[model samples]
Target: MNGTLTLDGFCHRLAADPLRYRKLHPVAMAGEFVDHFGVPPFPRMEGIAGLLDRSGIGTVVLSHETGGLRGYHVGTRDGGYLIHVDASEGRVGQEHTALHEAYEVMRERLHDLHPRIGLAAGISLCRQADRFAAATLMQPYWFAIFAEASGLDVVALQASYGRSYASLTIRLAEVMRHQPLLAVLYERGPQAERPPGMPGQVSEGLRATVVARTPGFRLRMQRRPLSALRGLLPRRGAPPPPGSVAERVALTGRPAAVDRVSGYDLWRADDLAVLARPVIWGGQVAKVSVVAVPYRDRSVLLPQFANAAFERTFHAHQVL
Candidate 1:
């Protein structure tokens, strides 16, 4: 992403360097930017701004939004672009918007050249731009570096990385962490009372709202319709069993690792084992993060989970 690079000429570069670049996907393109520019690990606003500048795009942070739009970009007569992000979205949201608008503005250039395009192409382009934004903002190579210290603590990662829960978690899933780990982040669906000692807690009955995992790891008997992710918790599922470790963690932010000699399974799956960790914000359990691994036998030893990068090993099992 050199300052000379222009949005209008992006397609031309793809055509000119077909052999060098095999795919036109935005995620791949964003990766190219990350690699090409040597974007620093754990980038922040200044870093992202540098990226935008390198891409020949001017930026403006507006205190107010326009027509409910969080961000938008416009082409300049000088054959470059200028992106504007509304400050109302907060720091994290603004960073995301800035990166997202950088990709989204490319669509305007494409549409200008081709007055009309197929419906599918337009939809595909938008999706690609979204992916590009995410991939660029969160460099995958940094995962290993971050994990070395904090492990795969999603709450800490989300906060430290300055990303939304859904964005960071989904990016983790997409990048495919090295270990065979699947971490699901979820919130309580309904409640009775905050378990004793867990003050300010509001709810019970945990339900998965976001999912992140290494490739191919899944719950047994999932239908995987539409998308493999939808089948994870919403389909053919129930809340973690009452008195189960998951229920305990959800009700109370205490971590749990238990061996099911003949105990509870979130859903009746023979292979689904779990370890529940509470994600706390402001001293209340905002949500729970589940680290699942495949293991069985009387010992209930979690040898398979050694590489999952938890700060401490999980002795038991979990559900999101």
Candidate 2:
């Protein structure tokens, strides 16, 4: 377990034998750790601290000068771990950092793998540990239940999970794997700089949009030729209609009615309609997630009418 392994190599090894690493998945592994200490679902600050304490993390300190570090773990004199959190990062950030550090500490104990002390290996290790932290904080099964009951509203998800937008979005993608749905994350950019083939650009305020779609949904999108009907990959310049859901949502941060957008949106199918929700962080629209159910029955992924609407909308707005 002690050697130089690139992050890519480590991931490839896990992918090669999924069964062996099955227990290594962040959610599954974190659940095991939580269960060991009888931690309940949606464990908050105290519960997380308890998990850290029981995982050989001896002390948790909040520091004013993290030196640009969000969190870090050091070996204690008695061979335990000390986790330091940057208090300036706020509560959510501190929680995420603590959990991530605790996970790495526990991982080293459970697997008997020596901690990578080298800077390069340490950086890779931290990245992998961060993924685990996200899964642990979000708790996939619990989040999936919430998503099913409440739908995929990014703001609501953040509130319920008590996690940062970035954490929830990353973990949400993992939970969406078993479901017949797609979850995407978009980074907002300026309206005028939208590249050709991007679908969700708006006027004046919102610019670059980054959409992260589920694997299955992305594949389905690839089979379609319509630029607007595909995933957020930039295409030859084509703007959605002025009053379309993409346009309205991009501009106003308000979701267009599902029925109104049923046949016209890329995320919607004949039977399964996608829901678009924006994640606003730091007083700006940082990301938008589009969740859609995958194909279940034999029907056109993109109907001719939807295609016609795209053409009409494109033509109508071309003069602008």
Models 1 onward score TM values of 0.67, 0.66
lDDT tens string, model 2, 1-320? 22213222233343445473575666665665554455566666666776556434546888887788997778877777778888788677777788888767655654444333212237776776777777767776678877655555555677677776655666766776755444444454445655555544454344323234445554344466776554343222333334444455556565432322233335554234444455556875665554444334213223322211222221121111
Candidate 1 per-residue C-alpha lDDT over 5-108 given as tens digits, one digit per residue, 9 for 90 to 100: 65445544544564533444667777765665566765677778776676565555554755688777776787777777776777767777777777666545
Per-prediction tally of clashes: 5, 10
Best by TM-score: 1
State residue 298's C-alpha deviation in candidate 2, in Å. Answer: 15
Which lDDT value does model 2 have at 94?
Answer: 79
- Give the runs in model 2 whose Cα sits over 4 Å from its true position: 1-20, 109-123, 189-244, 258-272, 279-284, 294-320
**Clashing pairs in model 2?**
184-212, 185-212, 186-210, 187-210, 189-207, 189-208, 190-207, 190-208, 196-235, 197-235
